[model samples]
Target: MPKLWNETIAEHRRTVREATLETTAALVAEHGLASVTMSQIAKETGIGRATLYKYFPDVESILAAWHEGHVSAHLEHLTRIRDRAGTPGERLAAVLQAYADITHERPQHTEIAAVVHRGEHLAHAEQHLNALVRDLITDAAQAGDIRDDVAPAELASYCLHALGAAGSLPSKAAVHRLVAVTLAGLNLSPSTPDAAGGDD
Candidate 1:
């Protein structure tokens, strides 16, 4: 086949696959995971059952793919926030705020969120996020904006754990408050302005 034809075919396949994943996720959200089926996804996606099967073996696989895509997008978003022009502390705060917003405004249903978070993609994403935060913390500490007594990795984990409460917050303000609290834990204290604060 001509290269142009091959590219077109690949693009078509990508479009179909994205549509299928989106439709499946929407159906699952609306009907609950257990109530969704392959046929329903096929119909909702406007694709034949066989065609849907070519992309995904079953609902679980489709959901997994969707979850992976979601996580990849989120990571990319965080990366952008991290790369923005700002002080290390400011950039870290922006990323933390964005993450907290994601939790506050979770797009997936409860069941889907639970299932997707249990997947390997989430574990890897968490690691990537942790590393990103750790780097930020290291920079901030070096700049004297954050406490440096403990390891950056340990502070990163603490930030993640503390900010996780954003998922249960009732409003965006509450999410921002949670991020503020999490960040405060890493901030240099006023009284001990020159003290390198971290767990010994």
Candidate 2:
């Protein structure tokens, strides 16, 4: 096949796949996980059942694909937030706040939890998130903005676990308060220079 023809076919397939994934997720969310079927996904996506099958074998597979995309997008977003210009402490705080916000705003459906929790993708994403926070903590400690008495990896784990509570919080204000408390736990010791913003 000509290069242009091959490119067009690839693009078309991508579009169909994305549409099917999106349609399946929406249908499942509306009708519940077990109630959604391949036919429903095809009809809602405006694609044929056969075409949908070429991309995904079952409703569970489609949900898994949709969740993979969602998790990948979230990781990319967190990476962008972490890479932005700021003091180590400031960037760390922003990333933690963004993470808490995402957790707080995520869908609370058990079906979603079921799909997202069973994949190796989740483990890999968790590792990436842990490293992102760990490195930030190390930098903040080096800059004297965060306490150095504890290991960075331990503090990173603590931050993640503590922020996980945001999912159950009743309000955004409460989420912010949670993040503030998590950050405060990393504060420098009172005897440290500039700990109280005193003059040199």
Q: Give the Cα lDDT of each candidate.
A: 0.81, 0.84
Residue lDDT tens for model 2, 6-77: 567878788788888888777878889888878888888887889788888888888888888888898899
Candidate 1 lDDT for residue 83:
97
Cα miss at 72, model 2 (Å)?
0.9
* 70-135: candidate 1 lDDT, tens digit per residue: 889988999998999877777777788888877777663778877777788788998999999899
> Which residue pairs does candidate 1 place in steric collision?
149-197, 149-198, 150-198
Residue 106 of model 1, lDDT score: 69
After superposing candidate 1, which stretches have Cα over 4 Å from the reference? 1-7, 188-200
- In model 1, which range of ten residues has the least summed lDDT? 191-200
Model 2, position 147: C-alpha lDDT score:
94
**Residue 156, candidate 1: alpha-carbon lDDT:** 90
Question: Which candidate should be chosen as best, given lDDT against the real structure?
Answer: 2
